[model samples]
Target chain A: MTGTELKNVKVLAANIRIDILKMLEKRGYGHLGGSLSIADLMAVLYGKQLRYDAKNPDWDERDMIVLSKGHAGPGWYCALANCGFFDKEWLYTLNEGGTRLPSHPDRTKTPGVDMTTGSLGQGTSTACGMAQGLKLKGSEQYVYLIVGDGELNEGQCWEAFQYIAAKKLNNCIVIIDDNKKQLDGYTKDILNPFSYEEKMKAFGFDTQVVPGNDVEAIDEAINRAKAVKDSAVCIILDNIKGSGVKYAEELMANHSVKFNTEEMVNKNHAAIAELEAFVKGAE
Target chain B: MFTLDHERKMGKRELRITVADAVNELMDADKSVLFLESDLAGASGSGKIQKAHPEQYIQVGIAEANMMGMAAGLSAVGFKPYTHTFGPFATRRVFDQVFLSGAYAHNTINIFGSDPGFTVGPNGGTHTTWEDVALMRTIPGAVVCDAADDVQLTWIVKEFAKSEGIHYVRANRKAVRNVYAEGSTFEMGKGNIVKEGKDVLVIAAGQLVSDALDCAEKLEAEGISVEVVDMFCIKPLDKELIIKEAAGKKAVVTFENHSVIGGLGSAVAETLLEAGVSVKFKRHGVEDRFGQVGTADFLQKEFKLTSADLENTIKGVLL
Candidate 1:
């Protein structure tokens, strides 16, 4: 990607991070770490890669996104809102009673969320089914399945992965966010998924690893994945648990954090201000 | 319109074959109608459909939870996905997925769980599921039904083709006694009164429906008038029919192939109590026990699920 194109996506990523922080902070507590980690990828999807219309979210010809690691719904919702799928003000009502933006991605409730997911590995199978449906219908549309590294602990993910690889469902691109940390601790300390690239390769996927928070790299990786024809494709994003939020990245309990303390509230405000400035400068 | 076959002969078509034929007809009619099996094509009798309509059939291979989510995914993309597996796996094993992906997500999926209750035969306790109806009833907007014959099972599959949301229809794989006649049509959420009487009302579902009718016939020979109503649709149960049937009856007896704790008995009990239609009520079935390895007949007797058990319950209730 060119410098200008990369900058554009980075700007998109910054805005997504800002919105996520604002929403979570407004709600006082939520899944902060996971949402922040996927901002760059979400930006790459909403900014350059995904073929969707803001006016018609359910357009048949558009490419779909299934946020399998649905706790990161703030990031997905922010990206969709930035792309005009819904009002940006709706982000403030995240997880509130009777709100459109739920704590997890719900296809029926959210505009751009193509698959309802929060129960970890179930979305992998759903994405495979969506891909198979597209193939059966002879549609060229693609489904981007966003999965968390920690979410792979679910056996259903492996079941879905095997099916996808065996069926050669190239239309569904599997993107695993290898943020290393889960709800409890580091994934290695917990389940120890060893090497995702090796595992995906053994599972018959044409695998690629890229920095999670890098806009240009993620964009290029997705482009490569889209070009593959014969085998299923998987991209592993190797990056921090809280990619853009330094305070959360350094904090041990960053997964579902409460900004109850004065320090936490201040830190969140400062982080959002910095990202907002970056977006403003890019614009 | 809710009459019985009365002859009580077993339907010529096995329920598995009936389900397969209905699914095949659905596939032939609509390109969007798809069938998914979890390595149970032969068990579900959909292997032929799988062979003929490979594009429309998905063999997910032993992943019941994944199959449910996959069907939800297919549903999201406007495909009417019909998923088949054993009763336990379909409801008990994949309850969360069915609740979240299928029902909570508002996706349309028709789940056909074969070999429910005692129908599992020697597949044993692990394969047997007596809580499917109870589990399915808890889900919001889920349509739960139990098939007593091929006619009812066939109508349910075809009816669900145009119906939206989560639907679960449990039936036996082998041929059972015909509760409804051939070419019989059914109204969803309405109970079928097989026999009318004022002495006692026997509300039953699945394999127990035929037995309940036989028990009613036996009681009639002994100068006792008994009513047998097929409470097939357990979720949006035929409350009107149940309330109406329970009125002026001497006693109410619920017989089912499931545990008496939550299946047809619980549903009927709740309906009767809530409607204030007080009567001598008895929930006659497995009393909070796990299924054991045995033939259907042996297990039925062991669980006291035969017509004789219904006769005892009816007599006990009348007294």
Candidate 2:
């Protein structure tokens, strides 16, 4: 919460947003929507909150983070690269064959990934297990799991939530990226999660709803969660699918935008340029 | 040759007690060893282990899927988690969790699928898991073994402690003949040749090993000269031993307290086919059928997984 640390987080967040745009632009088409939505949250976590060392990513005492909504891995990969877990040049290898940066984060391949997660609700259960294990071993390291709001439609998520609360795993933190969109359309049109906070509170979690794009707010909530002594914390992040770039944010299906022509690629570059200019101006 | 009193004086310990006692000893020795039960501790005869090691025992309600995932997580952070549940739930209900979390993810979690096959008895078809062995064997990189008796159970627990990755140990709740000696050595992927012969080979695992041994004895009296091999490890099968036995013998009869499709019989068949050994083979087990309610003895008889049935199958195959 220091002024200098606050500035670092904002800079990291802006850089992460730029990285997501560049990766998507390189891939020609990818999950720009949901991935961009989580950039600020990832910045807050990787920059100031989560206890991790990029140099020793496998440090046994490091805090664990599970990206349950693994399609948003570009956002996580960007943060990891920015944090020096691996070279930022490796970002272009996203979704490429023979590359360690897979579409879904593989724990063995990625330095900072704690669990290999892609099958939706299962990762939360894994996070719960890690948290419980740490508590059993009397380790102070925490586990942070991020699940897409639409991904909460899976019954297994609820099952994991109940177990986390039942075990009273105060060391575990769950963040639901409420971008409100999924593969088909909006979550409410698909399967509504109703109220993320109320549902999590019912399952015995200390619930918080915060503006997902605000790094300061995200960091404050995470600090509050760290201070909580008894209950597991659930943060419902209210975020837009494509939060930074103008063209991508305006598109309807930014989840996996198809940039077929040279014109589309140029447009994406222009939008990224605008974001870069705005970031530099703020600094 | 032995009278009823002489048989009673043999003083062999029951298999269920042996398994429970071994688990209890292990829990007492290792604090990192945890036992998660799905409300079957009393039936599995491991209530003592749970009672003595309450700190290490977790009763995860009756949710088998959740329990499997939880055990995987525990294994990820260095706890040796042993989840005990009935065979049906342990194999069928939570198979994905076992496949992905335990095997594919390479977690060293041991699953005790107790009361395998018709060993559940009057607990009936609903509880009997004749296909559990087949189901577990289908998972890649899974070490599936069914302990023949109390001695094998002790060896299996010890072996599993030294080994890594996922292991599914099928436990028969009913008491069976004690085949191995008190201090007999057991290997995970090596089969024990109980009775050596030249005419035919009898391959079996779990409770059916005793039936094959009895059949081998019966066949010996009739001058059939049968060899009985205890194929304990079903997955990563000892293909070299199987091929050697198959090449030496004219025919092979496989027995298991499971379905003939994908259990010990199929494992032997697959190995023989791959080795290009043209030995005649027959299987004695549940012939792709579900089980019914009865006593363990009665169900074994009903399912045709008995000494007489195995003997007939062996004789027919050899002839």
Candidate 3:
């Protein structure tokens, strides 16, 4: 990748992190854990990798992205708003009644969303279908899908993974946000999806593991996968939930924590301030 | 001895031949038009289309859910995909995929749910989908169509090809009476009034339209002038016509080869209630029960989904 492009991805990743913080701060409570984990990846995709036009979100030739772990849509909504798919002002409306930006990304309502996916593993299967369809039509556009590591426990995801590899959909890229924690608790204690990389590879995908927060490494892997032809590639991103915010990261119950107390609100604000300073210093 | 034109023009034998022919024609014209089957191509008589257009046809090997997802994916990238399976599998087996990927996502797909109701005959209750219409109608934005005969099937196939969004066209493999003449046009959500009467209105859908017409003829002998309506589109129903007919009629009888709960009967009831038409009504269908293995004729008799049953229901309501 070019130096300029690499620099752009880094900046975009940081911006996405900031966007996530701002959105969470506005909501006062949301799925910060999973959403923060995939922020950098979303930055890399929306910022540098994905070939999509914000002006024409419905462009037939545009690359498709399906957020299988749709609960992390706060991060995606932030990414979409930053990328100009819709106004950034709409980010505060997340999960509110009558808001186009629902808790889950709805394709009909959202500007850049390709499919409405909230039902765990169903999105991955839908992404596989989109990729296969692109291949059948001989379209060069690719399909990028993000699934939560914990969400892989869903049988539908494996079913989709099998089909994607079986079809040899080279135009598809699957990124699993390995945040370890699910709704109730950690993934290992609940239902361990032992080794995602090995499992995907066995299912015939060209699999790789990367630090989800490292935008450069994720971009390089995606570039390498894009270079390959006639093979499905999966990148299992090892990430910590609420990586950017120190307090949110430390708190176990912050997966969908509501900032009810003044102290909790102050802690969230402090985390956002720290992230902003870190991003400004990096620039 | 069946000529291609003769088969196409005829109503009873038309459904099997015309659908297969239309699919073949679509394949020839647009390379993007694809047909996916779930091991029932031979039974549905779509094997010829598959053979001639092998590249356009996908045999998914009995995995109905997988086929549904695959079809959705194909549609995502501009391919107009049509999936064929028996009514039971099409409506119930992979309902979630059909609901999300096809209907909810607004994918351009047409599902040919063949062997609806007692049409599967010897294949029995396991294969016959008495509740397919009810199941399909519940899906939002899903257009459910049951063609009366082959003529309507041919027209529906042609129209479906040009139309966009999710459409479920229920077809019976069994032969039935042809009602429409050649060049007769039918819209997606409009009902066709076959025989007009002032006494009562008989609203029916699918193969039951034939039975409704027959009931109308029988009812005429008893001095009850019953109007027969072919309520083809179950979802986005022809409310205006239904209300207009129901308002003037003494009573209304709804006949369908599906469950009375969410099928044509329910739709008619909802429409009538909304319009505030206080007409006495009787519903003749599968009375909230699962079907058993039997011949098509036998099952129809067992389920009371015949002209005689419909006439009796109408007469009983009148009494």
Kindly report which residue stretches of model 3 are placed more than 4 angstroms away from their true locations once superposed: A1-7, A59-61, B1-17
Alpha-carbon local distance difference test for all models: 0.90, 0.81, 0.82
| Interface RMSD against the true structure, candidate 1 | 0.7
Q: Lowest-lDDT window of 10 residues in candidate 1 chain A?
A: A1-10
Docking class of 2: medium
Over B34-136, each residue of candidate 3 has an lDDT whose tens digit, in order, gives 8888788778778988889988887766667767876776786778888888889888987888888777877767899888887878888788787788888
Scored by TM against the true chain B, the candidates give 0.98, 0.94, 0.94
Model 2's A-chain: what TM-score?
0.96
Question: Could you tell me how far off, in angstroms, the CA of residue A99 lies in candidate 3 after the best superposition?
Answer: 2.7
What TM-score goes with each of the models? 0.98, 0.93, 0.91
> What root-mean-square deviation over C-alphas does model 2 reach?
3.1
Candidate structures ordered by TM-score, highest first: 1, 2, 3
Error of 2 at B68 (Å): 1.7
TM-score of 1: 0.98
Candidate achieving higher TM-score, 1 or 3 = 1
Best by DockQ: 1
In the range B1-319, model 2's lDDT, one tens digit per residue, is: 1011211122266655666677677877888888777777778766877778778877766677778877877887888888888889889988877877677667767888878887888889998887887888888888999887767777887677677778888877666666776676777788878778999998899867777777777788988989888888887788999998877688988889898888888888888888899988887789878878999989988888888988888778766
| Model 2 chain B lowest lDDT segment of ten | B1-10
lDDT of 2 at B86: 82
